[model samples]
Target: MRLNYILSDLGIGLKRNLTMTIAVVVTIWVSLSLFGAALLAREQVDLMKGNWYDKIQISIFLCTKDSGGRGCTGTEVTTEQKNRIKQVIEANPDTAPEGVFGESKKEAFEQFKKLYKDSPIVSTVTEDQMQESFRVKLKDPQRYQNLVSAVSGLPGVDTVQDLRQFLDPLFEALNKLQWGAVAAAGLLLVAALMQISNTIRLAAYARRREIGIMRLVGASNFYIQLPFLLEAILAALIGAAFACGTVWLGWYLFVKRQAEATFQVWQWVGPTEVFQATGVMVAVGLVLATIPTFVTTRKYLKV
Candidate 1:
């Protein structure tokens, strides 16, 4: 009997402020969707880092004839110069002691052919055209600077390239994008909270006569406020469901179907990530609805 009364009051409140209720739902949906996308993007960036960072290496290319390597002087790197470069790498504890692998021109040519097998450049390029280099795998990939500083400007060292340098900027850009989404979501969430607060206040004002009777009949604050709280929670729940659905559809269409198809080497965020984001939306919705409902009823729903 009590549950039915609460449900009836909730329906009346929702019907009385239908426009405001719709506004709250739409606002929460957009905010939660943006928030979910941000979380998923963060997951994707971490996944890429886990898969790619371990494989990153510093390539120290040696001087070659016709190569514009620093101090190349139109001469091939000598055996003595090569040995000196190898000693520098071996001496650095930050670099993997035994992870130094040298690729000769012939080896570089073979790798080029395997990589660009279908490209016309393979037919035009020759073994001599490829620059020999030392592949220095790091004990800790973050210590790339130490290895590069040690080998740069060495007699045979033409250039020291850290593959991570090329990738860091891309990751940084993605992080900025994630934060931007979060900021937008925060603003929208605040708007939704205000809208909820106003809607509850108006509903309480409209039912002052019944609330006065309840107060005279010895009704507790909890009983008096239950209907308004239910109304807010129900609207938030519906909004959160819509947000979750939008996020899932986007991930399926853009990330799983499009991105994973093209970039098989890297792992993308999956359904598990979407589920986690949905959990966040649920928590946010509850907090946003509960706080405002409790505060508004306490302040404005008195008989």
Candidate 2:
């Protein structure tokens, strides 16, 4: 009987403020969806960091016949200079213990041809035109600058190029995008909470007389507040449902498909990530609904 009364009151309250209820649901849906997207973005950035950082190498280019740097003479670097450079790289503790490899002119030429196979100049370049180099993989990819400082201007060294210089900007951009989503989600969540508080206040105000009668009849405060609490929880759950659907569709249908077809450099977030995001969204919804309803009822539904 008490459950029946609470359910009836919940229905009446929802009907009375249907517009506000819908607004709250939509607000929560958008906020939680953005939050989920932010989580996915962070996962993507971390995935790329793990995959690419290990692969990134600092290339120390040696002098070739055509090399024009101050460190490069007009002759090909000698075997002695090359050996000296390798010794310097291997002796440095900053470099990966097993990651240094010497690329001969022939090997460098072959790699260049493979990389630029479609380019018209691939036929024009020859093994003698390619400069021999040492590819040094650092223990920490970010410490390439230290290795570069150690190797640059050495007898055979023409230039030191770290791949991280190219990759860091992309990662930084994605991080900024992730933080932007977080900020937007935070603002929307605040709006959702405020809307929830207003809806509860209005519902309590509309049923004030009944609440007063219940109070006079010695009904417990919990019984009176139960309807409002149920209403908030129901709305938040519906919103969370929407958020879950949005995240699942985005990950399974759009992001997964597009990334599988086009972006292969890093692993994409999978169903596990989606499930984690859904858990967060649902938890957020419940907490957002319960806290505001509890506080509002305790303060305004005194009768």
Candidate 3:
């Protein structure tokens, strides 16, 4: 009998403020969708970092006749100088085990030709013009600057280039994008909460006479508030369902279809990440609905 009354009252309240109920549902849906996207963005960034950071190589180029650097001379670097440079590269504590990879001028020229096979410059370049290099892999790519400085300006060394320099700007931009999404989602979440509070307060106001009568007849506060709580919970569940769907579609089209398909340099977020973000969205939506409804009912339903 109590459940029947509560359900009937819930239907009445929902019908009375149908407009506000829809608004609450739409607001929660948009906010939670943004929140879920922000989570996926964070996961994507972390995934890229893990996939690419280990493969970072610092290129140490030796002098050639055409080289121009502080350490470079007009003549080509000698074999002894090259051997000495290799020893220094291997001796570094940050150097990964068996990570010193030497590329001879012939090998470098071959790679250069393949890279620029379509360009006329490939014909002008010769093996003697190509500089020998050490492709040094480090245990910690973030400390590449230290290794670069240690090898810079050594005899026969022309230049040291860390791949992270090329990649830093890309990562920095992605971090900014992630934080921007989080900020936008946070503001929308607050708006959704405010809308929920307003809905609950308005419902309680409309039922002021009934609430007062219930209180006077020794009806418990739980009985009166149960219907309102259920209304909010039901709306929240609907909004969360829509938000989860939106998140899944976005991830499928953007990450799975486009990013993972086009880019092979890094791993992209998949269904696992989508599931995690959607779970959080549902949990947050329920809490947002319940807490505000409780507070509004307690405050407004008091005779």
**Candidate maximizing lDDT:** 3
- Per-model CA lDDT versus the true structure: 0.89, 0.87, 0.90
Candidate with better TM-score, 2 vs 3: 3
Which candidate comes out best when scored by TM-score?
A: 3
lDDT of 1 by residue, 113-226 (tens): 999999998989999889999998898997788888888888878888998888999999988988888898899899989999999889988888888888888889899999
Candidate 3: what lDDT?
A: 0.90
- Across 1-303, the per-residue lDDT of candidate 2 in tens digits comes to 887888888888989999999999999999999988888888878988999998899888999888886678888888898888898899988889888998888999888988999999998877888888888888887677777887888876788888888898998998999999999999999999999999998898877888888988888888888999999999999999999999999898887898878958777788887898799889999999999888887764464
Which rank order by TM-score, best down to worst? Answer: 3, 2, 1
Q: Per-prediction TM-score, please?
A: 0.93, 0.94, 0.95
Q: Which stretches of candidate 2 lie over 4 Å from their true place?
A: none
Across residues 1-303, which tens digit of lDDT does each residue of candidate 3 receive?
887899899999999989999999999999999999999999999988887888999999999888898787788899888988888889889999999999998999999999999999998878888889999999998778778888899989999998788778998999999999999999999998999999999999988889999998889888888899999999999999999999999888877889756847678898888999999999999999999988999975566
Which clashing pairs does model 1 show?
none
Q: Which segments of candidate 3 are over 4 A away from where they belong?
A: none
Instruction: Write out the backbone clash pairs for model 2.
Output: none
